[model samples]
Target: MTALTLAAAQTLSIAGDVPANIQRHLTFMRAAAEQGVQLLVFPELSLTGYEPALAAELAIAPEDAVLSPLREMARELRLTAVVGMPVRLAPEVGVLIGALVLGADGSLAVYTKQHLHPGEEAAFIAGQGGEALEWGDDRIALAVCADFSHSSHPRNAAESGANIYAACVLISEGGYAADTALLQAYAAEHRMIVLMANHGGPTGGWTCAGQSAIWDTNGLIAAASGIGEALVIAHREGGRWTGRQVEI
Candidate 1:
C-alpha cells in the first residue's frame, strides 16, 4: 500500500446526544483533515456516549440519513473516517454497537462488535463477521470494543490478510493496563499494526481512560494519549511507521 496516515480521536461524548456529538465529530474531522490524516477512528458509541439504555431508541440503520454529512466530509477531504454508534440489526432484534466506516470514495460499511462484554449482551447483539477496508495497498480490519479481547478477533483479521487492526472502545482507567497488554500482544502475535480509540470523558456513569494509542508490529506503543481530548497519529512512510500524539 502507499504510505498511510492514521489517527485515533479521543473526544468526549454526551449521553444519548447525537446532534451535539455529531458536531464534535465534525470539529475533529475538520482538524484531522487539516493535519492530512487519511484515516480517523472514533471511540465506541461515540455518537450517543455509550448509553446502552438509549441504544434501542437511538439505533440508526446502516444508511441512515443522519450520517450523510460524515460521508460528505470523507469524500470532500479524501479521508476515511469511522464513527461508533448503535445500529439496527433486525426489526425486533437488539441493536449492535457498530463502527460506521465512511470512505473517501463514498463507500460505506458497518462492522459491529462480535464479542459482547459481560454486561453488554443485554443492550446489544453480537455481529457475525468483521469488515475490511482497502486503501492503496493497506488492508484494514475494523472492530469495536470487546472484540479485541478475544484471540479469534485478531486471528480472523490476520487470516483475512489484514495489515492493520483498529478497534474503538470506551476503556476505563481501572482496566487500561490489562487491556493495553492484550492489544500489544495481538499486534505482536498477529504481525499487524494495532490502533485503539477511547473516550476522553465520562459516559454511562463510567469515566474512560482516554489513552487512545497505536501499537507497532513489534508490540510496542508508538503513540499514546493522556486523560483528555487527544489524537494519536501514526504514519507509515518508506515501509516504516512513526507515531505521535496531539493533546488539547
Candidate 2:
C-alpha cells in the first residue's frame, strides 16, 4: 500500500482580493511542495474571503485572468491543489462557490458546493452536479464549508466510494469545538479520512477558528493545527497512524 502525504493549510483570506489571495495560497503551496506533500488543501472562498455580499461583486468566470497563474503554479509545482473561488455561471443566477482542482499538469476539475449557508443563498446557487476525483488508491471528494454539516453530502461522497473527503471550510469561532467533534464522528462512522482547511483571523467581522485538522478513518483526531496558522499533515504507514505540525 502507498502512503499519502497530505497538507491541510490554515491561513487568512482577504475580502474581495483575488490576486493577493492567490499569492497567499501559492506561498503555502510552494512550502507544501518543498515539504514533499502530494496534496494541498485550502479553505473555502479562500480567494474572495467570506464576505457573501462582496463575493457577488468579486466573483469571476472560471477562465478568469487571476486563476491562470494558480493553474500554472500547480503544474509547475507538481502538486494537486484544492482551491476556492467564486465562479460565474450562465443565465444570471450569478456565481457559485466552487472548489477548483488544478492537477499536476494544469488540468482543471471543478466541484461546486451543493449545500449553501444561509447568507450564501442570496449570492450563489447550489451545484447540481455530483462528482469525485481519483488519485492513486484514494477516491477524493470535495465539499465546501457548510456542506459537511448535512449528512446527505458526505453520504453521497461515501456512497460514491470516496476514501478521503476533503473539506474547505470557513469556520467561525462560536461553535468550532462542537463542529470539530461532529466532524470526527462523521469520519469514524463513514470509515474515511476527513481533511479540512479553515481560515484564520477576522474577515468581515467574523473571527474564524483556524484549527485545521485531519481525522483518520477510525475518527481519531490524528493531526491538528489546534489553533492559529499551521500546516496539519496526516499519513498512515503499515497500519499505524502518524501526524505532524509545521508552522507556516
Candidate 3:
C-alpha cells in the first residue's frame, strides 16, 4: 500500500480579506504539495480571520468564483485541501462556519460546523456536518473549532469508522492547554489519529496559540509547530508513523 501524508497549515489570515487569504492558502498548498502531502487542512475561518462580527458581510456561497484559483491549484497539484470560510446557503439562512474540501480530482464538498462557540451563535448558526472523506483505505472525519469540545463528536466519528480526525480551529493562548488536552485524550480514547490546524497569528482580537500539531493513534505527538507560519506533517508508511515541521 502507498503511504499517506497529512499536513496542518498553520497560517495567518487577513481580516475580512478573502483575496489575500486565498493567495496565502495557495502558497501553503504549494509548499505542502512539495512535501508529498495528500491531505492539507487549514485553521478555522482561515479565509477571513476569526472575525465573527464581519462574518455576515463577508460570507459567500460555496460555489463563489472567488475560490476558483484555490480549487484549480488543488486539482493541478493533486492535493486535497480543506479550507475554512463563512458560507451562506441562502439569503434568508444564517451564515455558517464552513470547511470546504477541494478534492484532488476536482470535486467539491462542504462541511459546516455542527456546533457553535458561545458567542458565535450571534453571527453564525449550527449546521448539519457533512460526510467523512474516503481516501484509499482511510476514512477521515472533520471537525470545526467548537465541535470537538463535545466528547460525543469524536466518539460518533470513531464509531462511524473514522480512523483519522481532523479539526480546523482558532485556539487562543489562554485556551490552548485545555483544548489540546481534550484533543489528545480523544485521540487516545478513540484510537484515531488526530490533526489540529490553528492560526499562526492573532485574529479577531484574540491572541492565537499557533502550535498546530498531529497526534498518532496512541495519542503521542507525531508532529507539532511553534508560534508562526509553518506546516506540521505526519507520514504513515508500512504501519509506522513519522513527522516533521516545515517553516513556510
TM-score (all chains, Cα) for each model? 0.96, 0.93, 0.98
Which residues of candidate 1, in runs, are more than 4 Å off? none
Q: Which order, best to worst by lDDT?
A: 3, 1, 2
Q: Write the per-residue lDDT of candidate 3 for residues 159-247, one digit (tens) a residue.
A: 99999999999999999999999999888899989999999999999999999999875665654546889999999999888888999
Once fitted onto the true fold, the runs of candidate 3 whose alpha carbons sit more than 4 angstroms away are none
Among all candidates shown, the one with the greatest lDDT: 3
lDDT of 1: 0.87
By TM-score rank, best first, the candidates go 3, 1, 2
- Clash number by candidate, in order: 1, 0, 0
Choose the strongest candidate by TM-score: 3
Considering lDDT, which of the candidate structures 2 and 3 is the better prediction for this target? Answer: 3
Which whole-number lDDT from 0 to 100 does residue 127 have in model 2?
A: 81
**Model 2: lDDT of residue 239:** 60
Clashes of 1: 1
Model 2 TM-score, all chains together: 0.93
